[model samples]
Target: MTSEEEGLRFPILIGDVGGTNARFAIVDSPDSEAGEPRIVRTAEFATIDEAIAGSILRDAPVLPNSAVIAVAGPVDGDAIALTNCPWVVRPKGMFNSLGLSDVVVLNDFEAQALAVIALGVEHMEKIGGGTPETDAARVVLGPGTGLGVAGLIYSRGRWIPVPGEGGHMDIGPRSPRDFEIFPHLEPIEGRISGEQILCGRGLVSSYRAVAAADGKTPRFTTPAEITAAALECTDAVAEEALAFFVTCLGRTAGDLALVFKSQGGVFLTGGIAQKIVPALRESRFRAAFEDKAPHSQMMAGMPVYVITHPLAALAGLAAYARKPDQFGVATRGRRWRA
Candidate 1:
């Protein structure tokens, strides 16, 4: 049957599952918008099923017939494992245990990519560069519990979400300061992937590395503490570390833009990006993003934006669940038939 003919059965459960928290909401019908998402701490539940049972099912107006869960990991095969969380999501098992008709799983960034088209100007803060090119490829990426990367391409009059483990790629130092700080991070991160210096744990690593490089002891032990110190200008090392982090993030974002030829834009999302907006504006983020020689002019014209919406992934999931074919996506999640 056509996806429209097989329209999403309501009430449908939609969730943006991350390492730290899971946000869920319910939509009454295919045409209706999803309700405000309720957030549940990932640490509160032993398994994803328990989390779902405690939040969406308990408070939802009615038990959902189907669900779309966007997770912070690769969605391949029947068993989906989260990268920074202990939750292992078995779709078939969830279908049986929850008595759902079907379950759809998506990489968190893939969900973010889908959200881009639905986002309004109020939902996004433009960082730099020119206006986005119509129908061109766009990239969405950011750092939170972990780094995420995804590409959105317009093909055949539809947007296609390209999901992959792009954050695990090796990060190379491009500046003198970056080169000087690289050795200290090498000991902690081994190979120095993008996630090594761009995530929550990576923030602490950056702070420690910056402190050690300057022959000082690190006072902050957590990413939050470091960000707080940096924002308040109470710690020089923390401030420098945060600056360095933004520069690296911009550099990596620029690389991804080139990789995908994302003239449409490069969107930044995730908790960390929102928290560090002031810092990003003050840092060398824009300069770093447009530092590609030979193509520096080309890079200069690519717009960058930071998505501010809290439950963007859920909106994307809702959209996909309602009309999968419209976005050039196949609804092939594990289904339960009894």
Candidate 2:
């Protein structure tokens, strides 16, 4: 065995922390004899540190020296703040309290973006467009704890993840109903972001708007319920709501495609896309996706797929730990504890 393989013994702790829950795991090196890293228990705490403590208690031979956590929010340098949840993740302070050597905290979207580098045929469900070029830029986005957005730029035959707070971008309406709905939502205006209309709360709000448009009492429904009702074809209002949702998603996705000029394709991840694929496929999604102004046709040729693996982000964390140098990860602070 090569020294590169033999020297790989960095016991790492990795996690994908979102608004609702924090998922964690510990890996014993990249090519060491460690078995599959198991999930530590999830915590319902309000802060990242509390959640980290709970996860550590569930499974930890010892606190890890090298750790990386992907959190759902805009990572402003070392100060991380989540929009949907009440939590602030401070990497430097946590490292001191936890007695760890090194820790890297990245935007959850960034982590998901890194995870996209390791995606395979088994992890995806193709939705539309033709095959994409292998070495072109790819857009990675999804509706989750909030609408998370990121892009992967392939250069020199390697994938580089460019993370961003893209979900905070402005959202516009194309349909007349949407235009009418905009006024009632003016309170949100610039304050309201894509996450407000593209996430779970967005699904609920969309459903309510459609229902109210038909002069009916709005029925409370979860995003899952909205998707299921649409797929089952049991309610016309539900179907219409879903159609609008997909179209909006497509439009935002197209915007990202334009921003990145992603010829590699657009990859849709997160839990929400997996549950609503059928509705999305049948809706105005592809049409809206290709509705780019002058470059509409160009975008129509870009492939779009929904990632289906439940533990995809986990797999990404593993791959990143296995190849930190390959991922351009900068580990500041102390060295590995002996």
Candidate 3:
């Protein structure tokens, strides 16, 4: 390696910017080159730019020109807008403001998908299906405040991330209970995306619907509380709600796998999926995932991985930074240049 690459400084600034919070890290060089990055602190800042600016000032004498940001938004040339956050991340603006030369912007889920390609069995919790194959196409979905979806295709001996607004797609009811609650939820139906029933807030909505069905007034609770109650088997309504949620997730994952021909596997990420692993294993998720018209065996053979790594997205950012050439731009084939 040349001195430019070899002498590249340690503690590169990396960030995983989400709607609610932005996680900043000072990573040492890649494992092959240097020691594992010791996190200075996973500082929480109010906005994406602020978090990044703060991390930069605190970690090094000056900010590095090249930065890869994993943002929960759509990447459009020089302009990027987050789906959930109000921050508008523009590469040109950041460049002019920070006096940087290169900035890499990628869809958050797309970044996650990239990281999934590098993830090993130890980094994941397998819920069902057989072993994962290297050549197979894979799907990565995360349910948080919103549902994020991305497709990973094997091409040129590397995984390519194709991010889409899969969460905004129409959500269909699969069971009688779902149908029964449909009219009551009509106020939110057309306006509601898959995020309505597939995210943290969606858990609250699910619990409310089930509570109403049981002839009990609906009570509000956070997703964490709901999951805890269901796990302990103390709340039958919560359990039922969670069961339905898992089934829906499975059905949707199956649909995505079929659509993308994700023979590689399906990876479940996000805060909610990690917490509800036990319930998901016990629910009808696997059965629902495999319950297709004529491709039941195909879904059954597909491996499902639940991402357990805390810095999975950051790992993706690092991977992108290390090999930016592999990303090869978006579908339109637009290259990012100053």
Q: Count the clashes in each prediction.
A: 0, 1, 0
Ranking by lDDT: 1, 2, 3
Off by over 4 Å in 2: 1-9, 32-43, 184-192, 329-338
> What are the models' TM-scores?
0.94, 0.88, 0.87
Comparing 1 and 2 by lDDT, which wins? 1
Q: Tell how far residue 223 is off in model 3, in angstroms.
A: 0.7
Q: Which model is ahead, 2 or 3, in terms of TM-score?
A: 2
Model 3 lDDT tens row, 1-338: 32222222333455677766666554455553212333322234444556566655455654565566677777776667777777777767665665555556667888789878656779899988887776788999988868999998877865688888898777777678888664444235357567788888888888887887667775547888888888899888888888878988998898999998887889999778999899778749999999997999988999888999877887776765655556533533222335
Candidate 3 whole-model C-alpha lDDT, 0 to 1: 0.72
For model 2, residues 94-174, the per-residue Cα lDDT tens digits are 766665556666667767777777768888888889988877888889887689898888665456778788988888766
TM-score of 1: 0.94
lDDT: which is higher, 2 or 3?
Answer: 2
Question: How big is the positional error of residue 176 in model 1, measured in Å on the Cα after superposition?
Answer: 2.5
Better of 1 and 2 by TM-score: 1
